[model samples]
Target: MKAKSESLTAKQTIFYLLLSILLNSSGNGLTVSLNMGSALWTASSVNLSHLLNFDLKPLLVIYGVIVVITNTLLLGRIEPRRIINNFLFMVPFGYLVGWTSQLFNLLPLNQLSTPLKMLLDCFGILMVSAACSIYQRVNILLHPNDDFMQIIRFKFFHGNSTVAMWVSFVPPIIVSIICIIISRQIYAINVGTAFSLLFQGSLIGLADKIIFPSLKHHGVEQAVN
Candidate 1:
């Protein structure tokens, strides 16, 4: 019975993981197409691409590598399986974000008024937050950034999601500032970015309670094993 329960939980986790990825990718697509602003890490990537004259895709991988390193440090030990899972997550997530971005570009969101665009931007962030809650609870494969946030939330902040998110944002904020100093212009800092900074963590916490309340956070030890 115990083995059967564990097997069922594993299947459920995979289902939720894929669903969360789709939601996250769609949210990213909406934010990118609306063009008001992007999530802070994404904005930082854009800024770095412009300032360093590197292609966006390669720069993103470099950023992911850095985050992976940071997560390893936070963990206080190298967990090779967890590290590999984080990178593996990027493979499908990257392609999905690209395809979804193209799909959202076909929408009439851009033609909407400024107020409406801002509203949609916030909605996009909400979707991302909801996705975060689901996958973090699932706690299997994770994007490097999400893994960093999860480590902070559970390990450092005593499971305070909002505080962990704010702490996790520091690196991207510093990168954005550096790019501003060098380039003298912003790449993707606007209303949506502001929304994410202010409410994303809170929304994720909220989503955890309301989105799938039965799906308790899995044991970290069990997840990696």
Candidate 2:
């Protein structure tokens, strides 16, 4: 009876979480679209588009290598379902996130404007975190980018002892420093970007805590157990 109760509870939680994820992702998409529209309407009046020409290859290459390496390490150990799920979330989000960042730079505002910067940053962070939550709730694979750190925490460090969120930035943080050294790119590694990253890590974590419990209740925990 007790076991059955827990299972039921988990299912309920998962349903609610997934719904929230969907709504949040929709909001993020709409926000991005509207922002782009605003940019297009004002294109002729502003010169901020130059910021979009930033040479971000080095940063992207370094980050991509980390994700690929981590995914390779956990290829066979983790469920393939989680991998696929992550890919679905990360790819679309990655594309938009990149585009959003570029558009963000093109917005007719000063990055040096402290208040505006923070406001724009909050919006970015909220979007990332929201997508991360949705991705995890859909019964899909964990995104490859986060796979390595999450595996280490859950497998080696004991997840409850240390959350994967804190460690998620290690690879990127290192890469960001390298980016700063090689270029004068304003978006190289700013607070706005960091805030967005923190959301990405935290929301997936929220999903894990919320959705996985339900899965475990439904018997998905058998493999991890």
Candidate 3:
């Protein structure tokens, strides 16, 4: 009886881990695909000369590689139950929010009106929350030196989890703000550009916030049950 029970538990654990790995891989695939598609569409929007001048492929490849490495590290330390189930829920949700943002202008809103902008903000929160959740599920591995920032927060500040997260995000947030301003001024970023930016932001948020924590909680709940 003990041997059989142990065997069953082992099977269940493996199943959960595999499911998490699959979910992260597929979810990232979907996200990277969508972002690349959006960027390519942007590339198509301008003149050929301008398009040639703008080099995004290198950036794309870097982010892609980072995603893989981060996933590998995080997955190595954690079970799938900590990441998969939440991703299963939030990946689609983030995609939906992105789609909605990308289409809000087309849905009879007058050029980023107050109401439409408010709606975008609301959805943006939803997207960020979703991403943060996803990240929380993942352990250890992180993209683009963010883990280093987290460590700094932990070591120097003796910060709480929330503070650590906010501290880690500040640099990226500042960079993003600068990029958005430049995109608007230099690139003449239109409604679509704006939407894509928000979409991408929310995509990350969904992974980091919404799905990650949800998965962790689900795993804990399952263990308790």
Return the top candidate by TM-score: 1
> Could you tell me how far off, in angstroms, the CA of residue 200 lies in candidate 1 after the best superposition?
0.8
Compared with the true structure, all predictions reach lDDT values of 0.81, 0.43, 0.36
lDDT of 3 by residue, 56-125 (tens): 3333233334433453363355435524543443344334433443444344434456555444443433
lDDT of 1: 0.81
Stretches off by above 4 angstroms in model 3 are 1-112, 140-159, 173-225
Over the full model, what C-alpha lDDT does candidate 2 score relative to the true structure?
Answer: 0.43
Indicate the worst ten consecutive residues by lDDT in candidate 2: 38-47
TM-score for each prediction?
A: 0.90, 0.54, 0.36
Tell me how many residue pairs clash in candidate 1. 0
Point out where model 2 deviates above 4 Å.
1-66, 75-86, 102-113, 157-162, 184-188, 193-225
